[model samples]
Target chain A: DVKVTQSSRYLVKRTGEKVFLECVQDMDHENMFWYRQDPGLGLRLIYFSYDVKMKEKGDIPEGYSVSREKKERFSLILESASTNQTSMYLCASSLGSNTGELFFGEGSRLTVL
Target chain B: AQTVTQSQPEMSVQEAETVTLSCTYDTSESNYYLFWYKQPPSRQMILVIRQEAYKQQNATENRFSVNFQKAAKSFSLKISDSQLGDTAMYFCAFGPSYQKVTFGTGTKLQVIP
Candidate 1:
C-alpha cells in the first residue's frame, strides 16, 4: 500500500508568522500536490511538483510557496500567515501515469490567529 | 483549464438506503479520468471510485458506483446500503493523463439511522 505521511496534523500560528507544512510519500511517485480545503470553496490547489526541483503554481497559489528538493518530500510554505490562511491542508502523490489515482495523506489543519 | 463542480453541498440518506451525489466538469482534453474521493472526519481522503473517459463502462467498487456521462461531462457517485461509516465529504475530481487533478467543491454526506 502507498503511504503519504504529513509532518503535522494540527498547527497554530499568529498573524504574519511563517508556517511550513511537510509531506513525504513512500511510493516514489513523481507527482506531488498541496491543497487547501475550506467550506464552500472546496479544495483549491496551492502548489504542485512534478519532479525534484520542479514546481508549478496552482489556481490559488498566492501567499504560498513550495519546495521539492527531493523526490520523497514536498513542503508548503506560507510567507506570512494570516487568519484567512487557516485551513486544512492536504498532500497527495501519484504516479506519472494517465490513471491519476492519487494517494493522500491525513490533512494538516492550520489555524491562524 | 480543467474544472470540476459538485452542485450538492450536503446530502443525507437513511441507513441501508441509497444516495447519489452529483458532479460536473469541463475539460478540453480527449483522454482524461474522473475520481470520487471520500474524506471522513479523520481527514484522510480515500479513493472511492474512478472512471476513464474513453471507457463506456462505469466504475464500481463494493457499495459505490459511478454514473459517467462523458458527452455531458457529468460524473455522479451512488452509494448503496448507506451505513453510518459512509458519512463523509465526497469530492469529484478530474485530470488528464499525467497532469494535475482538479477537484470540485465537496458534498457532505450524512447517513441517518
Candidate 2:
C-alpha cells in the first residue's frame, strides 16, 4: 500500500519561532503538496513541488514555504510562527497529472502559542 | 477560479441506512475531474470515489457510489447500508486544467446505531 508519512503528528511552537513539518512518500510520485486545513474553510493549498527542486505557489502561500531536496521528501516551513498560523497541516503526493489521485499522510496538528 | 461547494455542513443517518452527501462545483473547463474524499478521526484523507467529466455513467465502489451530473456540475455521494466506519468528514473536490485540487467546506457525517 502507498503511504505518506509525516514527521510529527502534533506540534507546539512559540511565536516568532521557526517551524518545520516534514513529509515523506513511499511511492515514487513526481508531485508533492502541502496544505493547511481549518474549520469551515476546508483545505487550502500552500505550496507544491513538481520535481526535486521545482516548486510552485498555491493559492494560500503567504505564511508558508516549502523545500524538496529529494524526490520522496517534502518539507513545509514556517518562517515565523504565529497564533493565526496554527492549524492542521496535511501532505500529499501524486503522479504528475491533473487526473491523478492524491495520496495523503495523517495530518499534523500545530498550535502556536 | 474553480470553487467546490458542500451545502450541508453536517448530516446524520442511522446505521444500515443509506445517506447522500451533496456536492456542487463551479468551473468553466470542460475537461476536469471530481472526487469525494473521506477524512476520519485519524485525519488521513482517503479517496472514496472519483468521477471523470467525460464519463456519463456514475462511478461506484462497494457500498459507495456517486451521482455525477456533468452538465449541472453536481457530484453527490451515496452510501448504501452505511456502517459505523462510514462516519467521517466528507469533502467534495474539483481539479480543473491545473493539477491542484480544490476541496469544498466538507460535511460532517454521523452514523447512529
Candidate 3:
C-alpha cells in the first residue's frame, strides 16, 4: 500500500508567525497537492506540483505558498500565520496526471491564535 | 472550470442498513474522473471508490458503489451494510486531469450502532 506521511498531526502558532506543514510520500508519485478544508466550503486547492521544483496555484492560494525541493517531499508555507489560516491541511500524491488515484496523508490541523 | 457539489451536509444510517450520498458536478469536458473520499476521525483521507467518465458501467468496490449519471452530471455513492467504522466525512471530487482535484463541501455521515 501507498503511504503518505505528514510531519505534524497538530500544530499551534501565534498570529504573525510563519508556519510550515510538511508532507512526504513513499510511492514516489510525480504529482503532489496541498489543500485546506473548511466547513461549508469543502476542500479548496492551495498549490500543486507536477514535478520537483514545479508548482501551480489553485483556487485559493492567496495566503499560502509551497516548496518541492525533492520529488518525495512537499511542504506548505504560510508567510504570516493568521487566525483565518487555522484549518485542516491535507497533502496528496499521485503517480501521474489524471491517470493514477491519490494517496493522502492523515492531515495537519494548524491552529493560529 | 470544473466544480463538484454535494448538497447533503450530513446523513445518518442504522447499522446493517443502506444509505446513499448524493454528488453532482459541472464540467465542460467530455472526459474526466470522479472520486469519493472518506475522512475518518483520525483525519486520514481514504479513497473509497472512483469512476471514469469514459466508462458507462458504474464502479463498485465491495459494498461501496457509485451511481454515475453522465447526462444529469450526478454521481451518488451507496453504502450497504453500514457499520460503525463507516462513519466519516465523505467528499466528492472531480478533476479533468490529475494535476488538480476539486472537492465538494462534503457530507458528514454518522452510522448508528
Output the chain A TM-score of model 1: 0.97
Candidate 2 overall lDDT versus native: 0.93
For model 3, how does the per-residue alpha-carbon lDDT over A1-113 read when each residue is reduced to its tens digit? 78999999999999999998999999989999998989999999999999999999999999899999999999999999999999999999998745647889988999999
Candidate 3 lDDT over residue span B3-113, tens digit each: 899999999999999999999999999988999999998868889999999999999999999999999999999999999999999999997888878899999999999
Off by over 4 Å in 2: none
Clashing pairs in model 1?
Answer: none
Clashes of each: 0, 0, 1
TM-score of 1: 0.96
Q: Considering every candidate listed, which one attains the maximal TM-score?
A: 2
Candidate 2: residue pairs that collide: none
Worst 10 residues of 2 chain A by lDDT: A94-103
Task: Judging by lDDT, tell me the better candidate of 1 and 3.
Answer: 3
lDDT of 2 by residue, B1-113 (tens): 99999999999999999999999999989888899999997769999999889999999999999999887889999999999999999999998743589999999999999
| lDDT by residue (tens digit), candidate 2, A21-75 | 9999989999999989999999999999999989999999998889999999999
Task: Give TM-scores for every candidate, taking all chains together and pairing residue i with residue i.
Answer: 0.96, 0.98, 0.97
Q: What would the C-alpha RMSD of candidate 1 be, to one decimal place?
A: 1.2
